[model samples]
Target: MNELSDNEALMMESLARGIAVRAMKDHGAVPPTVLIGNENTVIEYASEALADAAAKDRLAQIARLLATANDATVVTTILESWARIAKVPGGPMTERIEAVMIMTEHRLGSRALLLKIERTEHGKFRRLTPVSVPGLDSVQGRFTGLIPPRSPSPEEIKQARTVLGLLGLSPDGKTIRHDLN
Candidate 1:
C-alpha cells in the first residue's frame, strides 16, 4: 500500500461533510454515513435501519467492516456521524454534534472533524422564520482527540507513530492534548 496524500484526505473530508450537512438540513438529523474514496471512484455506505439504542455501535461496525475489507489500498474513508459532545468544559454539559472521522490504511493515519450545529426556530404556526442562521446552520468546528479512549492496540500504536513521524515528532513518543470542545 502506498501513502495517502493530504489532498485525498481533504477531498474525503469535503465530500463527507457535504453529505452530512445536506442530511441534517433535510431531516433535522444526520444518518451515520461512510464515504470511501479511491483513485477514481467514491463509494458511500449508510444503514437504512432506524436509529435505536445501538445506532452508534451499528455505525462503528459498518465503518470497521468497510475498513477491514479495503485495508490494503483505499485512499481514505470519512465516517460521518451524529454524536454527542461536551457543550462546556469539564462541567457535564453535552450536546449532540456532527462528526466526521477520517482514516487511511495506506499509511495508517487518522483524524476527526467535529462540528457544533445550531438550527433556526420555527415561528408562529410552524412557519419558517427570517432569522434562520445562514449557510450550514451556524457551525463552529475544531479537531478533537484520538476519537476517544480505549487502549489502542499494538497495530494502532504503530499507525499513530507513523502519523507523529509525519509531524516530525518522535515516532515512538506520545504527547497529551486537551481538545477544544
Candidate 2:
C-alpha cells in the first residue's frame, strides 16, 4: 500500500469515527465492526464472532481476511474497549477508562484511534477525547494496490453531527449543545 494524501487519511479517520458513534447509539455499546472498501464500502458487524473470539484473535482474523482479499484496500474495525491512561498529564494512571477503539488498515498504512469516553451515573456515554498510544498502528494493510474511494456524501456529515449530539457533544460546542436543559 502506498501512503495516502493528508486529506484522504483525515477523511477515512472521520468516517470510521462516525461509524463507531452511530454503532454506539444503535447498540448501546460498540460492537465489533468491519468496513471494507475498494470503490464502495461494505459494513460487516462482528457481533456473532464476539462470543467465539478474544479481542486479539478477532483482530488477527480481520487482518488475515483483509490480506487475502486482493480487492480490499481499506479495512476499518471499531469496538468498545477499556484503556488504561493517565488521569493527569504526568500523574497516576486510571485503572480503567471506557473507550471506543477504531483501527484502520488503508492505502497509507494504519492507525488505531482510541477515543476516551465515560459512562455517566445515568448510563450515558459522555465525551470523545483522543488519546495517544505508541504501538496501536499494528494493523497495516498489506495491499498491493490502493483502493480508490468514492466521494463522501453530504448526508455523511449530517449523520456524524447527529451521532455527536447523541454522544453529548457540540459541533463547535457552544451553540449546538447536546444537553437537554
Error of 1 at 75 (Å): 7.7
Best by TM-score: 2
Q: Which stretches of candidate 2 lie over 4 Å from their true place?
A: 1-6, 52-59, 88-92, 134-181
Clashes of 2: 0
- Residue-level lDDT of model 1, residues 94-181, one tens digit each, is 5655444443323334544445455556511111111111232222222112122233466765665555445433321223354588
Candidates' RMSD to native: 14.8, 13.6
Residue pairs whose backbone atoms clash in candidate 1: none
Top candidate by lDDT: 2
Residue range 1-46, candidate 2, lDDT tens digits:
4445444455666877887677666756776665655444443434
- Global CA lDDT computed for model 1: 0.45
